[model samples]
Target: MVSRTGLYPGTFDPLTNGHLDIISRALKLVDTLYIGVAINRDKGPLFSLEQRVEMVEAETKALSDGSNSVIKVVPFDTLLMSFAEELKADIIIRGLRAVADFEYEFQMVGMNSFLNDEIETVFLMADPHHQAIASKLVKEIARLKGDITSFVPADVASRLNEKFGN
Candidate 1:
């Protein structure tokens, strides 16, 4: 039997509960999951790539339940489909939080299909509890001294607090 691999790529500026939800759910569908931390120098991310990767690695380390699947956090600075092909990922997992996100993601799916016809894209609806949580919004709230403990994981909240000196 061949093992299936899935790629979940994103900025993950600060890993949020919503991101973790997608990761947890994606794990069930593949034999291996790679959380690709996109290195977009244009976005001016709040956290460094290394920091974001560390946070994701720290947070997802426990999800590797011997028999289930393994989760790897990696940094990539290239077209997502190219990265997917490099990893030999069978599916590209994306999380949709709202209709607004769909419009953009739908376009991306079409473009990626043109780039790699063999790789498939999978969309997972955000859990209701995490629907409103976004890394950008969380950063803004944290910047304004708002409590973002509920939106992200404990380790992520701590890192954000440290980053903002809050």
Candidate 2:
């Protein structure tokens, strides 16, 4: 009786292992998970959208189990609720790592609910191991030539090393 499909929207400037944890957990909560890669240039990224998409695809290869596990990467250029509606997602999945994150996401949830009454957003707390992981932190570490092996997946770590390493 699995009948839910969810849209997880994020910039994912550089897909991290933390991001994968959210995706992996969300897969069990929904039949299909659409990983919406928001194209936001306001915050510059170490990797391009194409590179991020490839990294996401590569990291998610083992999770897609044909029927139940499905990860579709799509670029979102507009409002998240609009993208969710466009995808016909029954739910919107978000990850919450701290109270500060909740403050921001709460506003988004309110705005999204106003936009579409039928759609709901679910927030999953980041695993304790990944509580401090984020794209911003990852970028900063990479900029300093610091090891980010623990922050991102192996594939992502490799890509970051290639791009940021001299």
Query: Worst 10-residue stretch by lDDT in candidate 1?
Result: 58-67
* 40: Cα error in model 1, Å: 0.7
For candidate 2, write residues 104-150 as lDDT tens digits: 99998888889997998999999999999989999889878999999
User: Whole-model Cα lDDT per candidate?
Assistant: 0.93, 0.86
RMSD of 2: 1.5
- What would the per-residue lDDT of candidate 1 be over residues 1-166, giving only the tens digit for each residue? 8899999999999899999899999999999999999999999999999998998999888777643988988999998998999999999999999999999999999999999989999999999999999899999999988999999998888888888899
Candidate 2 has an lDDT of: 0.86
The TM-scores, one per candidate, come to 0.97, 0.94
Worst 10 residues of 2 by lDDT: 61-70
